[model samples]
Target: MWRIDFFLDNGYENVSMNDIVKHAGGSLATLYKHFGNKEQLFIYILEQKSEEVFGEWGRKSVCYEGRIEEFLTETGRMFLDLVTTPDAILFHRLLISIGYINDSRLNKTQIQNLMSVPVIIIANYLENEKVNGHIEVEDTYLVAEQFLNAVKGPFLFQTILGIQIDISEETRLKALKQVVTIFCRGLHVIQ
Candidate 1:
């Protein structure tokens, strides 16, 4: 999987199956048996990468039980940081290009499942807070969405539409912290 990322990051797009197999020191027959074709191989690599990325977040969220607002603010910044990395941004651009090329194979539900990791984590944190009387959320999902929207403007624009705005680390952290603080204030029980 790392080999695939390396090749793709190194500008090997639109290459043939033969090239991939040769580059990876494997045979055509083995490549065909394992991945079928170039598209399949690329999607397979993406699937593997998505799982590795989202799975790590899931694992950390499971063990997390800190202040819900602070936790979400930090986690949101981390998520944006991951998405903004060069390799990650390139992966998204490749997917968008593929989607534009009449190939919806990359949009399979299984692959799409990887994207819901943050939503799940935020919902979990909000629900936990509600349960513990730390905050009040009538609808966890919607609150999660609102919280996301608050910290979403910069990275979401860049990821979805190639908006080339530079977001500094300090600015990103401040934005996330403000969103979480606002969310907490909005939903907290005032005495």
Candidate 2:
């Protein structure tokens, strides 16, 4: 956790394994043995954060109960809350930097795993709904991708670019509500 915090405070290249060992109170050999190297440590941190944000997302069962709009709106709100946090923003920026800088540290598989977790979760939920006649989705995976993009589109780029990092609660709720409304309308959840 300290290593992750250090990485977030300092950029990827700025932080070193020595710094991590110092702040985290661990031996270099232990870190090396566990993570294999600094880059691997960073990747592990990303994995932990991704799990923290998107893990057990569907644990609290969605109660459709004839109010699909409510479910969609709540899910959209959760997605926004998870992705728009300061830490999440920082994590994504680090990911982008690693990607563009040609850092082979973050392998393609790790990148896909980081992104695919939520997509898989949402797609599975949609698949179940389609099966039960709650909604008619021809391709649940594509719809899930579209839904995530729609929710994150308004804020991710601005925050990642540092154009506007902070989002007020009122604005956040309003935007999420609008996204949810449009998503429901598109899916014909409400007519």
Candidate 3:
């Protein structure tokens, strides 16, 4: 946790194991024993952050109960809330910059696993909706990805570009409803 805080305060490249040892109260040997190197440590931190953000959402047992729209609106809000935070924005920027420098550091499998957390959660919900006969989705995974991108793309783009867009609560709620309605319609949801 200290290492993560330090890295966030100072960019990843700027921090060294010695620096972490100085502040984190661990010996160099112990640090190396836990994490092989800086890249590994950074990846570990990212995995931890991913789990913190998506773990509960991914693990919760839920059924739509014929309230798919309501579920989508609430999930969309949660997704937006998670992505729009200052820390999340900064972390995403850091990851992108790092990816450009050394793409291999962000291993494909690791990235897929991290990115799949939310998708898997939403896919499970969609599958439940399908089984309950509330919607017709030929591909739950693709639909989940599309729905997330639709709800999160515009705001995320603005955020990534450092643009400040003030959206009122009412406007945000209306937009979420519109997205959910359109998505459900696409799924051929009845009522």
Scored by TM-score, the top model is 3
lDDT of 1 by residue, 101-127 (tens): 664444456445555556777788768
What lDDT, from 0 to 1, does candidate 2 have? 0.76
What's the lDDT for residue 67 in model 3? Answer: 80
- Give model 2's clash tally: 0
Tens digits of per-residue lDDT for model 2 on 9-100? 88777888898888899699998999998878877877887777677666643555456677667777888887888888987887677677
Range of the 10 consecutive residues with the lowest summed lDDT in candidate 2: 58-67
Candidate 2 structure, TM-score to reference: 0.86
The TM-score obtained by model 1 is: 0.76
Taking all chains together, the TM-score of candidate 3 against the true structure is 0.87
lDDT of 3 at 188: 92
lDDT of 1 at 47: 62
List ranges where model 2 is wrong by over 4 Å.
1-3, 62-67
